[model samples]
Target: MASPGERAGEPSDRGRPVNDVQLSKFLSYICRHGAEKKGLTVQEGGYINVDDILELREARKNGYSVSDVQRVVANYPKQRFSLRSKPNDDGKLQICANQGHSLEVKGLDLVPILRPEEAPVVVHGTYRRAWEQIKKQGLSKMSRNHVHFAAGLPGEDGVISGMRSSCQILIYIDMKKALEGGLLFYRSANNVILCSGDENGFISTKYFEKVYDITKGVKLDY
Candidate 1:
């Protein structure tokens, strides 16, 4: 069932004419960061229609096939549109909006309940904050990858080491409890925070810091 010009990864024949959804996916794959305000722009259906063609032609010249182009273009248009709708103060894409853009609390916009700057702090109290931070900062936010690098982990992607797997902690501590229990801290290795528990499942670094009074006993010679 193979046609002359059609192969597994090849584009449909020259005039095959892909359907809208397929075309949309293909177009998105072709020029992911569409226009970028200077690159591609949308004409309809949240898909790029014009300038992407130019980029596609260049890709073609560079030996990129229709299928290859289709993939990259397909995945990122909605993100671009969301970024375009509300750019950060610097006019750059707010790559973090997918993480609720720090604009809501309890899945509700908190504009009425809190000020702009205060919203982040309030949102930080929620369980989803860590993921929000991850999306906003990528591998740079908590210095996860960097810490892992410093700790001597290997490979291109950062490794995870703390508390078994994903380093996610679930705890609800009020101010009084925090003062008595102490805050947790971690050391890095290949962007990983290695952790261990004596007998309990997982212990908070803050608790260790407080119980040992480590922060107080240390003296800086310099």
Candidate 2:
């Protein structure tokens, strides 16, 4: 039997040696091919592509922290890394069509201030009508307890249950801004008031279904 010193000299047999380049190539292949084969259409542009897993593994092998890989992959060429544990359903809002100048909604407005545990209020509507409803309700008016009836509560409303509740709203826009930013839809667990924004700030128009549908189809160039 080998002595303790002899055994210690032998290469560690615990883990496989990681090849960074090979791992990267494997990940890239997984990202491109796995997506095509699986028919995983791009949504909000953040997920674990094959390369991400490889990079994460290779990071472990190199004695580098997994977090380092996470940060790098987060800013990866394709925007492929996300710490978000859940799939993001938020959609983009943009100018209705070629008739208007190119415009994108401010992403900050929709970013979540609360976590899923908090259970905020959410809402959805066609592009044109979102803003009109918000203006009619007034932001300050919405915070009060008994004012939700003004927004037309549903008979089987999923978000609002008890007659009195305290909640914040999360809004999403479903209009196209560009070809890549297709017709979008927003849904949240909380009670949110939808609104429209002029590529600059929230606009006053209430987008209806026909208008939103046409815009969505037009953005896809249907």
Candidate 3:
């Protein structure tokens, strides 16, 4: 039988012949949601042992090696994951997804955006098709963990916050209203805004003060 490290295959500068997209999906699974399912232990800060992650059956099946994880952490366009030195062990390292987790990761130390000056004008992007429902119900986390927002509008220079290309509508959040309403917000390492939503998984429509149809020149008042 091949050793676990040998079975993981050799590392590559380009993250190997494995498709980058597939590898990313795999990482998102184990790092964010499937660690328990895969039998890997996640620490208080959501950090997982890199070696244990590499040993996962799913990871092995996908041909993921430690090097692939390192490369993805270093080069992924959005920087969706981060690595850190394990506590009390300077030489040891661990990794975790920066955000976008549906799992209830206890002790995840996300930085709070408390001061008004530190909180940017956050925006959420969606399609026009959902406008009526959103107007009635407000923005919800839907399936994933917290509600995700971008720091600002998508720029001409191709800086994508969290907006998808298919997003046709943009909702500007009134942070003042949210803060006053007692809703807390945190900024992920990748700069995505996350908030523990209400019981219905929504941030409530009241905070969505302005809506714009990017494809159209009109602003929606709701």
The model with the greater TM-score, 1 or 2, is: 1
What local lDDT score does residue 55 receive in model 2, on the 0 to 100 scale? 36
Winner on TM-score (1 vs 3): 3
Per-residue alpha-carbon lDDT of model 1 for 64-92, expressed as tens digits? 43443333233432221222222233532
- lDDT string for model 3 (1-222, tens) is 222233334455435555555677787888888888888888887888887887776666766767777766676767678888788976576998888887778777678988656765788889888998888888888778898888776663434456676688989888888888888889887777888777768888888868899899789988
Residue pairs with backbone atoms closer than 3 Å in model 3 (clashes): none
What TM-score, computed on C-alpha atoms, does each candidate reach?
0.21, 0.21, 0.85
Candidate 2 structure quality by residue, lDDT tens digits, 1-222:
322222222222234433333433444443323433444332232233232343344334653334333433333322222244433434321111100111221222222222322223322323334445554542222222111111223334443322222223222222332112321222212333332233333332232111222333432111
**How much lDDT does each candidate structure score?**
0.27, 0.29, 0.77
Give the lDDT ranking, best first: 3, 2, 1
Q: Looking at candidate 1, what is the lDDT of residue 46? A: 32
Candidate 1: where is the Cα deviation over 4 Å?
A: 1-34, 54-57, 65-222
